[model samples]
Target chain A: MNMSISEIEHEIIEEFGVFENWVDKYDYLIDLGKSIPKINPIYKTDENTISGCQSQVWLHAKCENSVIVFTADSDAIMTKGIVALLIRVLSNQKPEKILDAKLDFIAKIGLEEQLSQTRATGLSSMIKQMKIYAFAFKEKL
Target chain B: MSNKNNIQSLFPILKSSVNNNKLVYLDNAATTQKPNSVIAEINKFYLKENSNIHRGVHHLSQVATKKYENSRLVTQNFINARHSHEIIFTKGTTDSINLLASSFGQLLKKGDEIIISEMEHHSNMVPWQMCCERSGAKLKIIPCNKIGELDLDMFNQLISNKTKIVSVTHISNSLGTINPIRKIIEISHQKNVQVIIDGAQAAAHVKLDMQKLDADFYCFSAHKLYGPTGVGVLYGKENLLNLLPPYQGGGEMIKDVSLLKTTYADLPHKFEAGTPNIAGVIAFKKSLDFITETGLGNIKTHEDKLLDYATEKLNSIKGLKIIGTSSDKSAIISFIIQDIHHYDLGLLLDKMGVAIRTGHHCTQPIMKKFKISGTSRISFAYYNTIEEIDHLILAINKAIKMLS
Candidate 1:
């Protein structure tokens, strides 16, 4: 599936819009989270742990076809769904493109504001961690 | 006075709305809403009387001194302490506990012990923990039960000859367990051990009588009692207070200072050092007046009714598990849904203008005991109406569906 970052984000926005209420949007998210392929256990180490998150979230990436692919998981199901949204938009894209991409969908979806302060901080940390990974992977490419 | 809605009218904050929904503030266990009279009194103090107490002899100073000292008396009468001098003003509940812990550290030897409870707020726990470390004293905890109540049998065994002081909260802030503090104090006294009561949570719900409770030390925050912040009261039996020595060295705490020697000031002043929160102290008197006029009995009856109603309504929701189920509980309901995240529920509720507390609630040990990260807690005060609770019910139902 070859698509630009914006196309994937647009799909997410449309998918979220289909659900008129928060409940169904969450159900969509939960299904999306369950679809995320598990990262290899060897890569899930203390070094990959992102601090400042209320729940434990681990993200792992390896370069393939000059693009960065991220495999991540969260102890919390809701956080997993939130990370899945990030992975859907930024994963399978070039490291430079992932770095340059503006995640407008987060704001458009009202995910940041709708979250509690702690979880919002967690979301922010997750975004920062993914960007750090993309930038590092970009240097290698 | 009997009308709960009339009592709600006294607080101007209730007149406002949040997120276009009339605010249903169920976080009163964290802090109560301030009445209009208390707010006005705070402004009145800064406007007319704004001088330091005890040291100043000028007219405004004398006026401020009288007002400040009079607050001590009001606090003394409020807690039913024997003497006005026994009431010491500190920063807040945490400050009061730290004050006693530090001073009492000096009084303890290597082998002495202190008993606290697992259900205590961090304000009551950490201070004693640090004190134990500094004084080489052992800190013992009375275990909690499945229902969040402390084990009384274990408490009896914990008090011994080497136990210097036993500290416990009159009510658990997170669990809302109204502890049997009177019995705890009696047992401590029998063993010749001093007792400290952390009344930060109980001050609003439980009408305290320091003399009757016979607690050697009682402390609470003014902000939690619907007064201004940065002010707290410490009620100590005079003999225990006098023996503990001055907590801080400053202007008001000293009688006379020489080149190489200094004499400490008398009872209450010895503990209260330097400039105090004059406006906050005066306004606390007004907050007390609100409680006094409404009658603690009326407030208790209304809250007890609200708790029962909220419990039944909350229990009807599928997958909702109430954390603390003590029969002697106050008006707090901490609960967790089977699979819905607490943060998600809290955020969704916030968007709907129904405020509640979520997370560890600064009682991480209690959360650990339950084997859950956190719970959604809705705590009620006298001003919270049934109509407001209905809004909470509506929001919770919405949250459960969305998160599930």
Candidate 2:
């Protein structure tokens, strides 16, 4: 099945909307983080580590067949859950689409306003790092 | 304990709510809630006497100078220092300790040693570490046991003629261990070594009688004692303070200024160079007065009851484990639940209106020694009540249920 970034974001927003409370939404997010594809141990070095994060978060991306594939992990479960949400929306998409995508699902999911200032900065850093990867992969092509 | 309600009422912020629920602030070890008296005193100082000290011949300057110097006298008496001039005001405990490190550090020879405890806050550890590096001196650490009590016997063994300074925390911010400071001081004195007590945590819980401990220097942040932030007191023995050079140089700290040469001012001012937090220091006198009126004995009694009650209640929870278990500990209760990340627990509990501190409490060595990432700390104050604690327990239970 093929989906655009907006469609994928809509699906995620709908899933998050199913939860009635913040706790339930958080539980779902944690579960999603648990399911996040493990970043290769070789790529978990400081080189791949994202700065400005409260927790140690490592993201690795590959441009496979002109579509970006993202994998990530974190020492903290909450941060890992957040990274998983990013991976779900941004991974396996074209470099141009990834770079240009609105990805307003973060706001729609109430994360931007809901998160602590520091954590929100961490979230943005992760997104920025992912897009940089997409731009680099596009450059290589 | 009978006037517990009266004591709580003195802090205006205590009446406020968090997330529509009554605020249960158990983060006193981090900082304390200011009494209305202290706040008003600071406000009055800004309104009535807002002039810089020791400069102009104006009336406001004279009044402000009188108030600031009087606060120093109050602090000297509060800490039982022999002379008021010994109390050098600083930005905070970190600034105070850093001052000692730089000033006293210059006196150190190449092969000298500086000793710090394993459970010291980063403020206590980092300054000495930097000083040692700068002076080419050796840095040593005193180890602690499983329950976070410093090993005095080991500490004594580490002391030698080369040991120039033994710096330690009077109370562990993360572990709640009220250190055997007097004994440490006694032993260090045997070696003729100077000891610096980081009283940042203990300044509120314990009465600081400097004469009793006999530490060469003692420093504490005023904010932790319900005074304003950005102001702290560093109390040094008069003779020792005289020997050490000035930490900073500015307007008030100089007696005479010349392009070729300058003469430094006397003690306290020599160390306090720039424009100090004038309002903060003056308001600190009110905080000390608030504590004195409340009576140290009463505060201790109230805090002990809270500690015991919280310990017993949290102990009953099956998966929860208290981190520091020393019998001689103070009013802090640090704990971690099985398989629950402290950040998650802290985040959820914060939403439920319970304000507790999570993470290493700026003591990574203690966390490393305990072999855990961090523990959530719930430190009590005289203003905290049993009902607020009940709210905390309920919030914790809710967090566990949601996360687990």
Candidate with top lDDT is 2
Backbone clash pairs for candidate 2 read: none
- Please report how far candidate 1 places residue B142 from its true position, in Å: 0.6
Encode model 2's per-residue lDDT on B1-404: one tens digit a residue. Answer: 45777877888898888767777888999899999988998999988989989887999999999999999999999989999998999999999999999997889979999999999999999999899889999999999999888998889789999999999999989999999899999898988999999999888888889887798999999999999999998999999999999988888889899998989998878888888999999999999998888778888888999999999999988799999999998999999999887877777787787899887788888898888878889999888888888888888998888776
How would the docking of model 1 be graded?
acceptable
Alpha-carbon TM-score of each model against the true structure: 0.91, 0.95
Error of 2 at B101 (Å): 0.2
Quality of candidate 1 docking, DockQ: 0.32
Candidate 1 displacement at residue B201 in angstroms? 0.8
Local lDDT at A70 for model 2 = 94
- On the 0 to 100 scale, the lDDT of residue B158 in model 1 is 86
Deviation (Å) of B137 in candidate 1? 1.2
Query: lDDT per residue, candidate 1, A1-141, as tens digits?
Result: 679999999988887777776656666776776677887888889888764334567888888999888888875566778888899898899988888888988778867653345443366666777788889988887
- What is the fraction of true interface contacts found in candidate 1? 0.14
Candidate with best TM-score: 2
DockQ of each: 0.32, 0.41
Clashes of each: 1, 0
